[model samples]
Target: MENNRYNNFWRRLAPSVGLFFLAPLVGEYLLGNISIKDIWALPFLAPMYGGGALLIREVTRRAGRGWPTLILLGIAYGLLEAGLIDQSLFNPSFEDHVLQDVAYIPALGVSAYNALAFIVGHAVWSIGTPIAIIETLVPARRTTPWLGKVGLLVTAVMYIAGSVFVFRDLQREEQFLASTPQLIVVSTMAVALIGISFAVGRKPQPKIDRQTPNPWIVGTLSFVISSLFFGATENWVGVAFKLLLLALMTAVIIRWSRCQGWGIPHRLALAGGALMTYAWGGFVLTILLGRSETIHLVGNAIFAFGAIVLLIIAARKTHDM
Candidate 1:
């Protein structure tokens, strides 16, 4: 009985912990920042990124929403982090970033290009990708809520506390952008986006007679589209083009999903495409890290290969289902 109880405790805790690692591990460490190597940072980061991911996932799932609604919420999360917490979008010299002026708007006091890329990064890679990968790993719990009411309250508190902590840290590193008016505007917009997601939650998918495409095709398209999204944010014009591309791709996916035979395979493919970006980007970004050059690059390459294999296996399993 003790053993069974122990196992149940672990079962209940696993999702939150798994999600916690996903944010720092994949989003920060694997992506290039090596600070996550410090054990002390885990306490702080786990609540920030991990807590945010859990909050987004739980809120959407508990509300009975599907992937689309979850993605929208994830977008809101991204905006909140970039716009409010870090203010990277509005900071002209954020961390002395390379493209600080890429799409600088003097009047609005924001980088249009960076704003779009960062928000999309958090939405798809940081939040959505981890949720998909973790759910794939635990297929039995894929559609189910991972926490009860008490657990949710705890997670929310952690998230809010982490957000305040990050805001203070970022405040010291750089002077904040445009302050009150911008804060109010972005906050309002983020809330509105979240409201929209809830409003459209879990509606029944439309039906059609068209056959679903091959999983490989879906994955490849996802990879290509996502790559475009990642690379196309150097300037205002590119930002505009990328937005149009995103809208078109979204429309295509919605239309295709409504057709006959769409299922887990297609869904996994779309997710795999986005996941692949991180895999390869991990390898490329290793060069920019500026230390242990060959070794870091090789490690990133290995991680990328392993991720591809895992994704392939997941695709196969989805196909069987």
Candidate 2:
């Protein structure tokens, strides 16, 4: 009984784990050097902290339909950073486009990057969240469903579209002046479409047990401690942040899996965590490699291959269950 309670405690603590850890990490990364909008983005991804929590909370309950919010947050951030803000910060240019004149009121001083951030965020979101919602709507049964696959495809398309916009806009500022609306309009349309669906078929929200110890309590404390370790000033001192994050994430994944005992969703989370770790680790390795001239392609291949093999094994087990 004690073990069950201990297990339940861990189960409850899962969602807030990322938020609590990610905020200070962002602050340390920024060191208070950037604009308020940039600084705002430093923690909890600015304008989207609530959205991030909503995603995490939803995922932990009701088979995780809340992933869409995460995507939306990502899209919102991207639109702000890449589309709107970068107009000046990364690639400065003045466009006399009529729409932008309206977009940037003389008083607001809002950059093109700010206006376009939602596009990137919306695209990233469509990939992860929409599929999650549909799956929650009708989980995988015998029949292969179209909605899940379509959502995933849309994610890829949005990412590509965002990338194209970035590259083209960076090359010619006027192209961006004309293209900005295309990005915002599409993103707004998608949100409006999804909002209608979300409004009606309510996603289930698990109640917090009154007797249960709050998961956020311990999770938040651990996250603060983790951030301090990773948020060190010296680059060398913080080389281990990804490693630490992965270790904690792995522990969380393992505990959640064991607590739930190898069901479909638990196994899926394990796979997702492993993928997250592998992706982060791969990023670290690439940074260490340091240049395209002397890129460590062979080492990357080995890591990728090994991760894929592990993923396949775990997936097989998941299927068997």
Candidate 3:
């Protein structure tokens, strides 16, 4: 029985696992190894790739028994590539190539290895955590989180060991790191928010009753908090929004963490909260959290697209669920 169930598990896993790594793999196959131009493909596809599954779920819900919407999602996947890509860095000159070859990669001197490590690590955690939660929450074929936990824990342990290498290179990376105060503030806040997310991962939360949203105070606060993000735009508001979003996420996280108890589908909301938190973290970190003027240049492309995609999915799901 166990062996048969394990076979069924692999059946479900195969497609998603393919979809997950397949995005990057296909990009490389067509283009060649990751390059500055090709890798810019990272930010755009990263969100959609994972969100694609949810996107499929949403479209199917709306279409009501049809593969047509699923086909549409495939086309939209191209829009993700069409959206924006900065290929300026492909300078693969002697110096750039040398730097990469010498056990290094960097986003402004912080270490390329470190950034890649984080991306790969997050890719693993964010992708699996949601599916595991869904497995447990879905009305049928639910799997225990302990099964998920054991896998996640083993992978996390390996990632951490590699992170030790990053810590050692932190100082070496400092030379390429931003010297500006704003960038420092933003990156610091980003690290903190990610840390909180690490703690919140995949733990089932108590559902916030959708019908009785206690929106009285919390909803108002959510709106206010969201507006703070908007206002920060006009006035160099990186740090403020970063902190506010974190606080907001933290609050909702506590409420939703009891989803198993509340009988509400908090994943939609928690996904919203997670998206909000990580989206802001990515924004803040873009130019060292809030320092570099270059942020505006790349900002709208990555964050805006991800937000629009997320908000659309969230609104539709909330209405349906």
- CA lDDT, every prediction? 0.78, 0.37, 0.37
For model 3, the superposed segments whose C-alpha errors exceed 4 Å read: 1-143, 146-153, 175-211, 214-223, 226-267, 273-303, 310-321
lDDT per residue for candidate 2 within 1-321, as digits (tens), equals 999999965544422333333322222221221222233443333223323323323432333333334344444444444444334322224433222332343333443332332243233222232222223222332113222334334434543454455456455654434245545754575556445434532554343323322333333433453344333333322334534653675465334433423244442433233233333344453554352432344444444464455445544554564
Give the Å error, residue 248, model 2: 38
Lowest summed lDDT window (length 10), candidate 3: 81-90
- Provide C-alpha RMSD values for all models, in order: 2.4, 18.1, 14.2
Query: Per-residue alpha-carbon lDDT of model 3 for 119-153, expressed as tens digits?
Result: 32233224322332343233332321222435444
Q: Tell me the lDDT of model 1 at 240.
A: 94
lDDT of 1 by residue, 60-173 (tens): 888888888888988898889988988887777777665467877776677788878888888887888878877776677788899999989999999999999988998887
List ranges where model 1 is wrong by over 4 Å. Answer: 33-43, 175-178, 288-292, 316-320
For model 3, the local distance difference test gives: 0.37
How do the predictions measure up, each by TM-score? 0.90, 0.30, 0.36
